[model samples]
Target: MKKHQATAFLLLLLAALVCFFAGREFLTMHEEEAVYPSPHLTIKKRLSDYFPGLKNSPGDSSVYIFEGQKMGGTLLILGGTHPNEPAGFITAVLLVENLEVTQGKVIIVPRANNSGFMHSDPQEGNPQRYSLSTPGGPRWFRYGSRLTNPIHQWPDSVLYVNPAGQKLSGTESRNLNRSYPGRKHGKLTEKIAYAIMQVIDNEKADLAVDLHEAAPEYPVINAIVFHENSAELAAVTLMTLQMEGVDIRLEASPPNLRGLSHREWGDFAKTRAVLLETANTSHGRLKGRPSATLIINGKDKNYMKAAQLGLLFVPFDEDGISLKQRVSRHLASLRALVSGLHELHPDLCIQLDNLPNPIEVQKVGIGPYLTPSK
Candidate 1:
């Protein structure tokens, strides 16, 4: 009888130890990563500044503004809408750290879904964070979930009706992308969405871009999704991107898609809404084991095999698309988009300086453009 008790106690102790260490590792994700914005940054604000209800809330994301000495139109860049898509988030960070607008104002939200970064997608086995080589040292960024952390807003409903009255699974309630022109007294995710809309209206934004990524198997993998209002701008940008050697397609925002940024941002606000997507093997279903290396290097044998079988929409060879390549596509499209905007709205020409060169970025990798963390 004594032996049995001893054995049980030992097992309990081992379980407790495992829980303790696992809990500690999980807690570290809550500590947000630091970002150093552009030297030309005019001011820094928070989502709460636009919506006081978001103050001190997890949804209160940081907003960076860079204004040129000369007056012109405004552009808003939203990143980290889906934290699992690192390319979008990293592109926003690069712009924040290296961009300089010389004619118009630019606003950036590097982490649009602040609560999303506090957690990773459950059961996908994604790493909590990944590292990139910088001139000074390694800089780390978190890989967050596609939805808001349940901790921030718990007890999800069985069905979710977004601000636009689109019915979605309750799980999508946490998806910031699905929450459009959010509700003032809605859930945490909704509040974040609402705050973003406020920025568009309050700042008189002329163009708004949301950065994102998709699996190679996805049909919309390497595409520019634009609202009806932005059709002309997207067409011009698509041609320019092709000229720059970037194979991209244009996907019009479906009118029935009620709550997405490209759809709702256009219907609700005067700003032209657009979203950019790049292929990421790390985010694909066929990806082998999820790890920091897979997220950074983006090489996956499974994807290559699938591509050979004609399963993927984008070409996936042994030289799997690296983070550098994905980011370069985004930058190229951005430059084209901005130029297109100038052509469409002559008065709203947003001349930018110090934007990363897409071709050069693809050649050297993402490290050089980023400022090393202290």
Candidate 2:
């Protein structure tokens, strides 16, 4: 070969080698993260069992069941509906690892949007994974995108119309939250939603709670959005939380907002539905230094500035809102909701024996409650 041609060939080969290695690294990152549940887990299944369409699909996710010896009320918890909110996922996982149901059942879906966990949003510069140190070793969980991976479900229209007849941005079609009461033959996200509905139906759930986090600047932060059917429960929950020193606001689900879990689940299922929101600065647009530390610490200087200018919904200070605080708030609110439900319907009582209270979680941190990695 000519001198210039030989050099060009060598460069091409080197580029190809680099691309091969990079591609392998990217694919390997998609390895599924392991979640070890409490020894009390009675049953474990996949979302596909409810909607067979999701079998072997990226949307297929695990369902962890903890059934008490005696039959009673059933509670379903959804986590990672918006993968950008890490606290929701963490809280759900913590529940699975630590909770021991005594007089009822608890169902946990730690990765509600399972497909979303396979990839991160482009240009978001999000960490691919975050690690938590356990007594045995370090365990890592995927830091996923806010929406479903487009590779699993494609072709967004200009304005996507949901099964609920609500129009949203085309990109929102990939959001699991906007495709509730989903159809079995619909898109991947819709199929996932449909499967969850099936679980609620099959399990005869009494209450369903979806955990989420919003940007610190958003108005809905640190609040519970409950369906009309859950109004009495919401009121009682709010009162109990206040008595426990957790000042949480309760907002009724908007009638016009279609396809949301709080609305659709309540409308379709016999279960009362409530969605909880916590303040997450890392996901805020005003966040700086987008790193795992920012996600865990929940601290952002820009958010502090925004708070000073009265642009934030939640109180943001130099100390910042840590992950522990957000998780504690969610857990506390959930306990209050369950207590309210028990009071209203004595026959459908769910007696949870050991849940780390907010005060102790804030004082001792979440590590103590989480099961050690194996």
Candidate 3:
């Protein structure tokens, strides 16, 4: 009896230690990340402003607006849809700090899925934060998960039936992309999507672009996916990018692929929507040891081997896909897309200035474009 009591006490003590550590990690994940915006920002609004139901919820996020004295078309840019893709978030931050619109208006949501930034994907071994050295000081940004944080909406079902009636794995229930044209009273991710849609409708945006990155091995690497309504703009943008010596492929959004941003946002908002993707080594499955260094430097030996094996869609060698290159591609694509829109509708032109061009940013790097915090 004494032996059994002693053994039970030890098990209880071990359980308590495990709980303690787990609770600490959970709390740490809740900490909010910050970004310094440019002085040119006209107004900053919250996602809850459009969807009152999401006020003060984990899904609530910021919307930065840069309006000019001249009246013209409105364009919406989204980043951090999938937080694991650092380039998307970083490029958005870079734009928030550097962009100054002179005609029409530009609305940016740097962290579209706010909850996703609060946690890392389970068992992925990804770094929680990555830092960059700027002229002012070292700036740190959170490395977040691919989907909405489970803590905000838990107990995934065996299967997820999206609002559009598409079926996916239970895990996709947490994917914000799969919850588009969202319901006002839907789950956490859907509520976020709904708020975004509200922003588009309320602002009467002329064009919407979603930024993202994929593993080199993914076939969609270095490509632009556009809705049918945006096909002409996509073609023009692709041709312009090619003319500028930037290799980019254009893919049409499959009508059957339900619930995607390119598909649903266009359908619901009647606005042209496009999604741009870049190659990122850190986000790839064949990446080497995951670390903050890898996220910044973007070098991975395994990806190099995969490239040699012809398994990667993008070129990978000793010079891995650096964060600078990825941001350059995204900013270039944004420029091309906006230019194409101006050509298509002269009345609805969104003119932007003071944005770092791809070639310039590639040469000078993202540090100079980042405004130091006061």
Candidate 4:
């Protein structure tokens, strides 16, 4: 072979090798993360059970049911609405693996936007996975994109109009949180939202909580945002959390916000809807580097400096807010909300037990509570 022809052939072979490995890494993200449900889990269903259109789709996710022998009210907890938020997703995993319901039912959707879990946001330099040292071994979870994977629904519009008649940036059309009370024939993200609404309506849920996390600089950090119908419950929850030294604030869901879970779930399904927010430094733009350590340990020199400048919404210092603390905050808030609901309506009281204490979780960390993978 001629020298130039041989060189060209070698270069093509090298490119092919690179593409092969890169493609494998990319496809690994599509594999669902392992979550060992607690022995108390009664049944596991798919999102398609509610909305059949979602069957065999990337958006289809697992729904875990923990039903008690005695009949009572039902509660729905949604996690991973934005897959980039690790604490939200981890907390749901914790509940599924540890919680025991004794007098009511608890339904948890750990990956509400399943499609979003299949990819990381472009240009963010975020880690694709982070691991925790569990007693069984190391448990890894994906750190994915905030929006639905474009591969599932492509070609963004210049401007997207929601079912509520509200206009948003075209990119937000793929945000699961912004597609609530979704259209049956809408986009992939919208169909997932619709399926959640179906769960609320068909199950006759008395309460629904959507778990989320925000950048530490966001003003709504460590907050409980509830629909108008849940104002009293939220206020009580805030007070209870404060009394327990949790320092959570309460925000009422704005009526004009069209597609949010708190607004749409309450308005359409008649279920008391609330959303919880925790502070996550890993997700903030001000963080120094994007690494698995940042997502798990959450220590960053830049964030500490920003805190000193009064630029952050939550307190930060040499000891950064670790994943344990963030997950503990979410757990504490959930406990308070459940207690408040029981107080407000005796008939709708949902009793639970065998939950890990928030303080203990913060102290010992999440690794111990997580069940070992078989």
Which one is best on TM-score?
A: 4
User: Which portions of model 4 miss their true places by more than 4 Å?
Assistant: 1-8
- TM values, all candidates: 0.96, 0.96, 0.95, 0.97
Weakest lDDT window of 10 consecutive positions for candidate 2? 25-34
Q: Model 2, residue 208: what's the lDDT?
A: 97
Alpha-carbon deviation at 334 in model 4, angstroms:
0.7
* Alpha-carbon lDDT of model 4: 0.92
Question: Candidates ranked by lDDT, best first?
Answer: 1, 4, 3, 2
Clash pairs (backbone) in predicted model 4 = none
**Candidate 4 C-alpha lDDT tens digits along 131-162:** 99888899899999999999999988889898
lDDT of 3 by residue, 77-125 (tens): 9999999998889889988888788899999998999999989988889
RMSD of each: 1.7, 1.5, 1.8, 1.2
Q: Show where candidate 1 strays beyond 4 Å.
A: 1-16
Candidate 2: tens digits of C-alpha lDDT, residues 1-374: 89999999999999999999988867755687777788878889999887788999989999998888877899999999988888899999988887788888999999999888888889988888877766676777788888998888898778988879999999889999999889888988989989999999999889999999999888998899999999999999999999998877889999999989999999998689999999988888999878888887888889889999999888899989998899999999989888898899988888776777777888887777777776
List the candidate 2 regions with Cα displacement exceeding 4 Å. 2-8
**lDDT, candidate 4, at 327:** 94
lDDT of 1: 0.93
The true-versus-predicted C-alpha distance at residue 139 of model 2, in Å, is 2.0
Error of 4 at 345 (Å): 0.4
* Stretches > 4 Å off in candidate 3: 1-22
lDDT for position 136 in model 1? 95
Put down candidate 1 lDDT per residue, 262-316, tens digits, no spaces.
9989999968999999999889999999999998888999999999999999988
